[model samples]
Target: MPSAASSEAPSEASTAPWDVHRLPRADGKTFLVTGGNAGIGYFVAEQLAGTGATVVLGSRDADKADAAATSIRSRVPDARVRHIRLDLADLASLKASAEALRSDRLDAVVHNAGVKFDQPDRRETGDGHEAMFGINHLGHFALTHWLAPLLAAAPEGRVVTTGSFAATSERLDLDDLESTRDYRPDRTYGRSKLAQMLFGFELDRRLRTGGSTVRSVVTHPGGALDSLTPPRPPLHAPTTGERLRGLPAGILVQGKEAAAWPAVRAVLDPSVTGGQLWAPRIFGLRGPPGSGPSAVIWRTRRSRPACGRRAAT
Candidate 1:
């Protein structure tokens, strides 16, 4: 059992503001971070490990997942970390993957893994849904359903969905949800992420209505550029020139390490309630985690139900 100091939510008015650098002790808690093999997910996992919690990295690639776990253990010598095979693209396999999770109780699950294609070509998941929408939205949705029992068993379980800033300017096209009619790489990706944001909020609404204990929170990693991020050995080793080049952009954007702050805060911050949006403080671009405005598209009643129905189908 976690100590009272670790599990209880700190008083917002009495306690000092939450600090990303110094997280509360989570000795007996367990957290799962999807896409923990690289980018923002890796940093989220690493930071969570520092809190004495058991962190599980969920990825499709077994080797990459192992490498990420190794990198984390190297940094935090006694870090209790492991990897799980979680291919979000394959809907049928998510149940097995959820079952394979060793922990009996899950304190939190960070839905961070997503797919984005640079080329104009539109891809589809093995389940026949649009690649970005399927993996980014449906995968996490299904996984949450399967993991609900474990989450409910915890003292205070949380589900943190990592959305994208791009979603702020986009709206889901219910008429063509899969982008089979008019698909532009960037627009489709943005719409897919929007669907995810809506799901996070809707999930919380339903959870509260059902009188469930689990909380669902939404977050976005401002503008996180790889060039600005620090090196993590085999996982990521940006050259000095790259870091220097990214220095100028540092004023507006930040490294992936910093971007991971919002998700980490959403997961561990006891004060953070379900259905709230957390993002970087500076123009939703870079800085510490704080409450941010959610897109009007996600707030609409029609869109939320449509998103849930589409993902269900």
Candidate 2:
């Protein structure tokens, strides 16, 4: 974990609110962001690359990763970025991607790739698990297992997981790990997100117990809409009524750039600690990054994070 004092300096260094543009130099550091082809992931990768970090864009599609890297280069003329083919739905691919990084130590790993919504019917991955649970939770679980050693090798290594508001509504049913019985798409996705929170906080507890400096932090981009993001492929064409209703909701919705703030803060901000959750400042729907405990993780009225055994679910 980075020194709390070091992270505090930047706050006093400037009067401007914390954002990606204000991050300190990252010249020699390295970061890997899953789902970096587009959305918040792409923007995060671009922001880090702009800060001189060697960013690796992990995506299932090599072409899309290349395009994202090219876009980053176009913006940061000298940005050093690379691509690694990663399919979080496949366990074998996750292992292979980890192996590809074996020779290099990583400063941070951003678990940003996940199925945003779900299909009408529940689907399973090659691992024979529910699609959302398999990709969002288990896949990242396995990836962290495989890469933890590499991350541990770095100074104050960090792991940042993308969580969701769904966690606030869903209950974690470890017994039904795959949601094999009467699975509802939305509920299953919620359960998966809750699992993500559990895993992240639990990992922090384990790391602390094991006397490791690595930190595990979770963040969410609340109510961010694709309509507010940059133009990209796989455009979500909202229906007329959807747009009509979204007009009022748009006040609460933000672009992907704003959505990426909390995750970026969790990953790079030295003051942030393990087991803490970050979200937007305004009702967690939109605004600058803010720190707090997840409602589901500890169910506390106070903002204090779960520490030690309390972090264990």
Winning candidate number (TM-score): 1
RMSD of each: 6.9, 7.2
Best by lDDT: 1
How much lDDT does each candidate structure score? 0.85, 0.77
Residue 299 CA error for candidate 1 (Å)? 6.8
- Candidate 1 is scored at a TM of 0.90
Error of 2 at 163 (Å): 0.3
- Candidate 1 lDDT by residue in tens digits, 82-147: 988999999999999888887689999999999899898888988899899899999999999999
| Residue 254, candidate 2: alpha-carbon lDDT | 83
Q: Please give the TM-score that candidate 2 achieves against the real structure.
A: 0.84
Per-candidate TM-scores read 0.90, 0.84
lDDT of 2 by residue, 1-313 (tens): 2111111111222223565568877888889999988888988888788778889888999888888888888878799999988988998878789877645688999999999555678788987988899999989999998888889988989999998877666665544667776588888888788778778888898999999999999888877776666544332245566546656766887878778888888877888889777877676778777775454433212222345333323
